[model samples]
Target: MVSRGCCPAKIGELTLWWKGPLWLHKEDADWPKKKNIYCQADEALLEARTVSHVLSTVKYDLSIVEKYSSLLKLLRVIALCRRFMHNASKKERLSGALQAGEIDKAESSIIRLVQASSFTSEIQDLCKSSQVSPKSVLLRLRPFLDKNNLIRVSGRLGNASTLNESQQHPIILPAKGVFTKLIFIYWHDNLMHGGQQAVLSAVRQKYWPLNGRNIARHVVHRCVKCFKYRPAVVKPIMGDLPEARVRPAQAFKKTGVDFAGPFIIKSSLRRNALLNKAYACLFFALLLKQGT
Candidate 1:
């Protein structure tokens, strides 16, 4: 213990995470070991793929206003004129119902898939069910939040949402990304915490949403020397037996010769005349030894 903070050992342990033991629950303890599905960056990769495909495909449209037009092409010109009508010359003006129109048929012009995919019940259901707007909840949640915590949820009808898995939510568990090690630290004593802390510790010493002193307690406890020498507090909570370890039993046999020399009262079997002799010497040897 010192004026600045409590230091357990001589050099004192390096402070690893700023949000220490209290943040212990979220920061160090909650990380998972296996590859999380969300980590595939599917949202990002899919967006990239869509952009590339669209760019590559855009150049191939026959788009010229000619007498010959495929059914899809006919609708495409009508829709394109409507989409760009505000930018088009006055005579080329067309209705802009494609996006604002409540009817799904408005988009039948652009792509064959759009019209086909509209029939998919799943997509229609998704559009109607998204009643929760981000502003309503975020506004109320913002007042309750302090400097340390932040809550954000943004998902449009057809877009992916954004959530930081770094902070684990009690109800909604974000997928755990890749982690370093998995060590179970009993929550009570806060012993044996591992994984993400080992990873994040490299980045910062003190993190936000927490005070200064508490951070030191966690960092010092995890240091190599301090952890090895930290006195084991074997109080309750550790149930009766360790119960996690097991071993097998075996047998051994030995045979050896030995000499017995002694000086003591005569044995009941000894009716020898020299009962007062200074010492008695006797030898017994084992012939063999075996184990069944």
Candidate 2:
């Protein structure tokens, strides 16, 4: 019988002993079964250690580490995540409305989503951080923001800040780079067969993407339908004169008459009375050959 820890001191020693001819001397018990049992135990120990390591990691708090970084970056990331979630939710809702063929409802829902994703307090904070410049789209909206003309409303994408006009309820655009493509696509679909001015007008009523007019014009210019159906305004070529006006004719073949005016004639009788009350001067012209 082999005593535990007697044949070998370390695991390596035991492995060498088992691999060598020394194992042949252990004929008292089944060495193969013991080897299988030992292997299983080692695997179980490794798995237990792995699980413990994972649980230890879960106990730590990562938020404290994130706090050391610039706050603006964190806020921007949070705002971006919020906007993404809001857009996804609204897209689902819009899809449902469109699937039901409720066009008005879909349009209203889209407008609501766009309004919801407008500029918010996070954007204002970002602007105040000096990260955005005067030439930036957000900075250009400073006038509206300062005048209190734009109102902020609670929304899924943080807070929505936009204009409150009846005819032009413009949504302060978010993620200009990404939403510009979306806006162009929407305008193209909505204003199918419409002109650039029409697309611009339609987009202005609901959205205020940067360079919106240029985007609309670009989409219009790229539309095959618009190019194929555009009306041409070329001046028509003048034709030759009619036979009646151009052909020669006999003298007096045609005549035109006109009355000149009423002329007064004085008589030799009474000085105050006229011989004839009035006489109308007459004139006539005849259509003839050049010599006649």
Candidate 3:
């Protein structure tokens, strides 16, 4: 009999044997990988559908005039004429009453002068028509009268029935010059220099001058008491550094010293051992470098 281990191994030899040839076939080469394509045709179609819907729903009126154009024009003209007639009649009635003994002579004269100045082409014509002098208040208010056309004589002055009450006696004034100054002083003093709003209120109670708030602010701004007592913000000025800190010096030349601690230290490892005190001190010095 052959020895069991005699032909056990051989170099580069397969120890296990196959009964049949191995089945092997190369897989068909993978088709070239296709790139993913993203299409926006659906999104474009959706946007076009939305735009078409909006265009179909929107309505625009392009006609110049509707069916009732003539009727509307007639109604508008009637309304305008009615307003003009009412204003004209009211002005005539006021002028007659003003020229009569109903209102105070001084007040009436001022109102008539304002009305005349409002309608006149030139200041000289206003002066001649109203018999007002060049130094009159109305003369000074020529520009204001031209701009506002506020000569409504029918309404009571300061809405007051009578002119005796000082609070209800209205007076027209030019924005500048002696009359404005005097008015401002009278109201400001009466209100005890009580700030801009207070003075404005007092003036408005009796006066209807143009640019009255501006005058009040001007007077208040110049008030010595207001200036002296008004609250103000103050800024603190920074002080200069000390000569030692600012001047160049060597390290430790001018140093600051500090004490840190006095810690307790045990003399021995035993719990009954005596304890000792320890201390630490620190010193800081300034340094200067080219970059710093």
Candidate 1 lDDT (Cα, whole model)? 0.32
Per-residue lDDT for 162 in model 2?
Answer: 58
| Candidate maximizing lDDT | 3
Taking the tens digit of each residue's C-alpha lDDT, what string does model 2 give over 96-212? 212323333333333334433554443455447633455544654442331223322222332334534523335555444334445565566666657778877776665566677
Off by over 4 Å in 3: 1-169, 237-292
Query: Distance (Å) between predicted and true CA of 245, model 3?
Result: 25
Kindly report which residue stretches of model 2 are placed more than 4 angstroms away from their true locations once superposed. Answer: 1-136, 143-169, 174-179, 188-192, 231-292
**Candidate 1 to truth, TM:** 0.13
Candidate 3, run of 10 with poorest lDDT: 15-24
Which whole-number lDDT from 0 to 100 does residue 105 have in model 1?
37
**lDDT accuracy of residue 42 in candidate 2:** 32
Q: After superposition, how far is residue 86 of candidate 2 from its true place, in Å?
A: 14
Off by over 4 Å in 1: 1-192, 195-209, 212-226, 229-292
Q: For each candidate, give its TM-score against the true structure.
A: 0.13, 0.33, 0.29
Clashing pairs in 2: none
> Once model 2 is optimally superposed onto the true structure by TM-score, how far is the C-alpha of residue 140 displaced, in angstroms?
1.4
What tens digits encode model 1's per-residue C-alpha lDDT throughout 100-161? 34122322233223212222332233246533244332222221211222222222222323
Candidate 1, residue 196: the lDDT equals 34
